[model samples]
Target: MPATFSTLAEFRTLLTHAPKIDAIALGEAQDRNGQLTKPPGALGRLEDLAIWYAGWRGTARPSIDAPQVIIFAGNHGVTAQGVSAFPAEVTEQMVMNFQHGGAAINQLSKAAGASLDVHALSLDVPTQDFTQTSAMDEAGVVDALVAGWNAVAPHTDLLVVGEMGIGNTTSAAAIAHALFGGQAEDWVGRGTGVDDAGLANKARVVREAVALHAGGDGLDTLMRLGGRELAAMAGAIAKARSLRIPVILDGFICTAAAACLAQTQPDALDHTVAGHASAEAAHRALLAQLDKQPLLALNMRLGEGSGGALAINILKSAVACHSGMATFAEAGVSDA
Candidate 1:
């Protein structure tokens, strides 16, 4: 059977109207945790993160079975303006590195025992002998993203979205400004080690790109400056939410794609967990605007889902405690 795509409006409403956390189950999980022969609250946020996961999945035995990370790679048009420190060819190079298990994400994913899927939605400069597909348009973005979701939907219990694009940070900042009504100065930041002058130039380029794409639809802005991978990631988020799957989001560029998805479908945030606090200033502002709390703050600037993969370990530990720790009753200990 062919897959069906959910509209942004419908997704927004469904997420908004989704049921609240199950208080009884949450309380039970908390009580069980307290009676597990350990100091109360000793686990810190892991306890809370675990209980939240319990409520999120509505099961005390909530497990992160089949955890998978999807890293979307593409090329941004803003690279033409020299805003980024790295050359645009870096996008294709990094995509290859990801496929070959040489990137940070590869190491992190292996450590966390999560599967990795790399998508090359668009490569401005294609590399010979690389296994990647073409850049996708708006509809193509929807189809490709939805197809990926359908392929993994039945087996995966958790999903993480990451991005790899040379000038994508600029493109993401531009999208943040255009859709969220922030100034170019408010949304722009140093991407890949741009100096002070380079940062100013990056901001100016973003401002210009925002001006050029102003007063048009969201999808148009995506097609103009946004990479194909970002657009595909946005669609992936929507499809995951429609399937009631929880999504973990990466740094600034991924969050920018997510912001675009949220603008189109506000409820998408309901199923999302911000994975890290990026060093990029724009990332801080975007997280503030979205009202999200990241799971980690490691001054990480590298993208490719490395931060998200690191955060997954915490999530895994949380689920382990929730599912495997014994209650006082199970341990034959009296509760005081």
Candidate 2:
């Protein structure tokens, strides 16, 4: 299936037909696990992961090959309010670093045997400081989303989506607060290690933005409070779901994309795996709301798909144990 969507409504409709995990294959994967040349449940989460991947791929023995990372980098006007610990310029600088193969994600991608991609989108224009008004109008949001969906549609492989906008955690928190109805302090955290004054200001800014458009719902809320890269990620995740491709969501900013999609279409969450638990205070609440359990708890807060890159190994191990290991019957081991 081609990943082509010119409108947000079109993308939303695709979710209606998103392929569901194969139940029969899922059961067989678990059964095969029990028959492997090892004690029952000896591999813990790895065993469970094999079953999950099997269901997603509709294969009892799943494979993880040629994983790819798509990183969307944008700029936020709200950084002017001192909501972030770093300047907004860092977004563009890090994007250049990614292009030069020097960022953390570049190294992690090489180590994980995955390709790295980065999109440096329009950073400055039309992104209003949310403390004043909506981030982008409906059309602008849709355009960003279309770009993201188009990027993912052609690739048929395991996917991980990441973000690179400075002050994006601020955008994510604001979006979360609006969708989930939480206090600003509860949803906002120190993005990129803000100081005491910075954290309070970020929370305050988020509260102001949430209050500004408290009545908006669905994509309206997202367009009003979301960042460009976030809108793109939401579209990518939705497209991946529509195609039955497994997605490993990165840390805070990335999960915010998942949360954004979940706000409109809850089923999209089924095609995803939480890569890790982030240090962001709001992430746990968001994950709980989505009913997602992350594979790692490294306390990592790096946003450049760092956690997701590391998680590829664990997913590979699940496939390895499922396909590479011989059955007890094949190994001539006596039944216990």
Candidate 3:
């Protein structure tokens, strides 16, 4: 596909018209849930999630089909500051963990029965030997993301985007400030559990990074501070919407990338489901702008798509209710 959007408004309109919850399918799902062996409303949110999934896919019997998880790993220049307890080298190590199938996301994905693809995006770090993929520039990010979308386009019914980059929260805050035009302090937060002094340092780093790339456009901001993984995530979102595939976003970093994508193409939000609200205050602001209510709020700040894996179970429950339950007419139950 061509990597062009005449205007942000045009992109937004394209996303808005993307796949939506199917009211008819949702109604059918609720009816089926009522027909389940359990009492009505007994299944709680599980049933609700199933109905929502059915509606979102516009199918009375929606399935995850080829469930795939894309984990984008990169390094951040802002990590040079003491924002995180871990060093930038850990990003490479964790990418190895992902390749070796030992990370939390790997285990959770296995438990959830979802396939995984790890993309080693080049940002500020040297390319390593763990599944070496091309580094993404502004245009490269868009193209790589679109290619990823096309790779899984035909098989998957849903998409989950996860990221791993040390000091990514710093990059996220900078992007958030640029896209939303907020103070760096307003977008900055304690990433990886930084204490008072550490947070202050992180805030300072963010302010400097934002100042470094004062202006240009969204793509410029992304290239200057945003990791290649985040850029690819933004592109993946656009491609996903173009394919009408639903995506579940992870944490602050992923949400920030989504925000960048949304700024470029507002309608992308239409196909996205906020997995959870991060403890990061900036995440709250980002979700508010998207007008998305998260599925969970366990104060989780892990950036390996753990939240997305957790949310997948809820989505599965929704699918089960919609596909397995019976309707009132089939169950001989009274409408009244």
Candidate 4:
């Protein structure tokens, strides 16, 4: 669907008016779960996952037939601060790899039967270093937001938004520290295999950036400290909430993007679940702040929505068992 709003103010208004889950579907799904021919709580979290997913899809017995993974790539100007192990050129190169189906996310998406789409946001023109000024002005951030908003296909039943921007971990750390009011080291992590010295430098950069761009609300914080890809992830997540599509959030950077939403509106992430707790050291803490329990935790930290893509199968299995299993009467099984 086309974007119905453009500016950040309009976007914030859109968020305030997002659709809520289908309560009738939730009730019916709960009723069906009770009669699924299994002992109570036998499926553990899967039962809850199915019910939550059912409410979002507006069907008591819903299947995830059309899962979509969107990867948003952007070059960050913060790499100039030596905050990343890899250079910015890799962002564009990785986009090409994703296009060629050669990246890990491509294989994971295919394995989970999800269609993949990638949007590279202005690779040649990176965001401002942000240590000097806000990473993006209102216009730049809005464009990225709109890009993410329009990228979600209206027919998609399940959504996963990922990022492929170098130096974004620093941006994530800065955003987290700014929003959560923590020391910089508390939120910084070794991203892209940076060395110990590089890690310290990364933390320092986060501290300085957050100090410079402190005291803004979620959207202001995003515009000040977040890159285009980060803003885009936030945008896609908001769009998913508006369309009532259940989202499987990726790792730390993705969670940081989602954090902007949570800070903006407490219930903005009601439709999203943590796909995985990544190897990123602070990801667990970030997930905790969002009150999201990840569905998987394989010590995986390779981004590009790889973790979320892997989780599609887990959600699929939950829905399959919930919707496809026969009730006790249908199976002629005695509940007693």
Candidate with top lDDT is 4
Whole-model lDDT, model 2: 0.83
Off by over 4 Å in 3: 1-52, 123-137, 143-153, 212-220
Q: Write the per-residue lDDT of candidate 4 for residues 30-140, one digit (tens) a residue.
A: 999999999999999999999999999999999999999999999889899999888899999999999998999999999999999999999999999988999999999
Q: Residue 260 lDDT in model 1?
A: 70
| Model 1 C-alpha lDDT per residue in residues 1-336, reported as the tens digit of each score | 134545434434543554555677777777767777567887888888887777656676678877888888877655656778998788888889899988899989888888999987647542111001122344555554454445444566777878888877777887788887867888888878889898888788777766766665455555455666677677676656655567788898888878876665455577778899999888878888788899999999887877888888888898898788887789887777
Q: Is candidate 1 or 4 superior in TM-score?
A: 4
Q: What lDDT, from 0 to 1, does candidate 1 have?
A: 0.72
Q: Note the residue pairs that clash in candidate 2.
A: 3-153
Candidates 1 and 3, the one with greater lDDT: 1
Best by TM-score: 4
Model 2 residue 327 lDDT?
Answer: 93
Assess every candidate by TM-score. Answer: 0.84, 0.94, 0.81, 0.99
> Per-residue lDDT of 261-321 in model 2, one digit per residue for the tens?
7777767788788989988888888888888899998988888888988888888888889
Ranking by lDDT: 4, 2, 1, 3
